[model samples]
Target: MIPWVQLDSAKTPDGGQELRLKQRGAEFSIMLGTNELMNSRLSGSEEALAKLSCERIVGRSQPKILIGGLGMGFTLRAALAELGADAGITVAELVPAVVAWARGPMAALFDGCLDDPRVSVREADVGHIIRSDKAAWDAVLFDVDNGPEGIVYKGNDALYSAAGLGAARAALKPGGVLAVWSQGPDSGFARRLKQAGFVVDEVKTRANGKRGARHVIWIATLA
Candidate 1:
């Protein structure tokens, strides 16, 4: 068995926690304390986040997508696979080091998706981008933090709060979709999505291509 090697570390924007990147041979993981935020070997749910959302807006001409996190670029790659050449995707990743890792040790895992002509990477909070735009995106996909209940950063709570959901709503075009990935189900979060004027559908998916632990994905669409 190959022992995990700590390749690098970065301080969260809030300075509340340190994110460590560990690699065991070809497998990679991004961890916060004892919690593993993401693993390269397990990307089924993350890929689904993009596939499911793109399914909803595939009919649109040149659809614009905003991805909250760029972990390993699984979601971005999946989105690129599902959408047409006219589609554009903007990814907002709060931690600059995560982006650096994708270009550094994890570059092979990304497979040059970051260099795609249709993709743009932003080193900023996804929440701020949501609030900054109004009805600008056709789909907003969030794979940030753990879920509505965040563990990596204290400030991430707002992205799942009522105000945050409202901002997300305002940032999407009519009939757009907001897809979220979670480790587990949160009925309260689903209800909050409804209260914020979205039709929510909860889907269950595995972390590792139908083998690992079941994860939750909320597909919320604006009527």
Candidate 2:
């Protein structure tokens, strides 16, 4: 077996905690110590989130999509596979290093998604983007944090809060969808979605293939 090599590293804004990127043969992974934050090739959470989020409103021509994170580009790729050419997608990635990792050592995992004409990558906070716009997107898919409850960053709390859901609602077109990915079920988040004037649907999917880590995808529709 080949050895894992450190490809790159960066310090986050808030805590100055280090984010490390590593490559083992053809596979790439992000880590914060022994914990594997993300693996591009495996892409369990990303694939599930994309599929559940895009399942319902896929065929709308010129549909606009807002993806909250750019982990491994799996979500973007899966979304592209499901959406049409006329559709456009904007991916808001908070950490520039993650974007660099995608374009650098882990580039191949993305399979040319960065250059896709319909796709744009933004280096900024997704919460800010969601709060800024009004009725701008046909679909907003959020895979940031580990659900309504976050792990890496505390600021992520707002993305799952009532005000954040409200912002997400304001950013969507009437009948537009806001899909959020979670590591586990959050009945409280579901309730918040309902209270925020959205018709919510909770869908659970496996992290790998049709079976693996149990993941939740919350599909919320603007009412």
Candidate 3:
């Protein structure tokens, strides 16, 4: 049996928690305390977050996408695969080390997706990006945190708040979709999405192919 090796660690923006990256043989995982935020081998829901959102914006000319988190490049790679050359994606990763891990130890897992012409990576808060522009994205996918209320970072709660959802609405073009990945269902978040003028659809998915963790993806559309 192979033992897990800690490759590196980074402190959360609030400095209240730490994110640790570990590798076991060919597999990799990002952890917050005892909770594993993401694992290279379990990316089904993350890929679905991209695939589902891309499907909603098909055939749009020069579609723009904003991905909140760049965990192992799962969502970004999946979006790149589903979207056409006319589509562009901007990924905002809060922790700089997460981006570094994607280009460093987990580089092979990303498979050069970061270098794709349609993709742009930034080390910044997705929340801030949402508030920075108006009607800027065709699809905004959040592959960040545990859920609306994240355990890794205390500030993530604001991203799911009423005002935050409103900011997301203002940032999205009409009929654009906002796809969010969660470990499980949070009925309260769904209610908030509805209250924010979005037509929300909650979909269930697995962390891995037909197995692993049972996850949830909320595809909210701004009508």
Candidate 4:
């Protein structure tokens, strides 16, 4: 059995805790304390959400997208592949170390997508950015935390709240979509999106390439 090796660590904005990145051979994991929040090669749910969301939002004119996390850049790269040359992307990553990992060790996984002319990386909280902006994005795809039912951090609870959904609705352009990735189904959150005045669609996809654990992606449209 291979032992986990520490790759890097960063202090969260609150400064009360730290986010750590670890590697066991080719596998990578993100941790806060004993909680294994996410893993690069293991979390297929996030990747599926990114791909499906981009497919729905991408158009002939090219589009602008905001991705909430840069984990392994699977979503980012998948989006760039789907969107092609004309589209532009803004990636907001809360943890600086994750960004560093994207450029440093995990660069190949992203294929230098971060340096792509069409992509811009913002080092900030996604929730803050969503609240401050207005009608600027075509699609806001969030894979941050662990969906509405958070496991990595408690502060993430707000992202799935009614107020958060309201702010997200405000940030989107007309007909823009808010695509969220969740490990499991949350019927209550779907209702909240509807309560926030969005036309919502719940998509279920397999986490394994073949077919296995089901993951959910909530696509809410500001129609």
The candidate, 1 or 4, that scores higher on TM-score is 1
TM-score of each: 0.98, 0.94, 0.98, 0.90
State each candidate's clash count: 0, 0, 0, 0
**lDDT for residue 59 in candidate 1, whole number 0-100:** 85
Clashing pairs in 3: none
Better of 1 and 4 by lDDT: 1
Each candidate's root-mean-square deviation in Å?
0.7, 1.5, 0.7, 1.9
Q: Residue-wise lDDT of candidate 1 within 1-223, one digit each (tens)?
A: 8899999999988897899999998899999999898899899999999999999997899999999999889999999999999999999999999999999999999999999999999999999999999999999999987889778877889999999999999999999999999999999999999999999999999998969999999999998
List model 2 lDDT by residue over 82-164, tens digit each.
Answer: 88789899999988999988898777888899899999999989889888888899999987766787566678888989998
lDDT of each: 0.94, 0.83, 0.92, 0.81
Q: Order the candidates by lDDT, highest first.
A: 1, 3, 2, 4
Q: Give the poorly placed runs of model 4, Cα more than 4 Å off.
A: none
Task: State how far residue 115 of model 2 sits from its true place (Å).
Answer: 0.2
Score residue 3 of candidate 2 by CA lDDT. Answer: 95
Instruction: Score residue 214 of candidate 1 by CA lDDT.
Output: 94
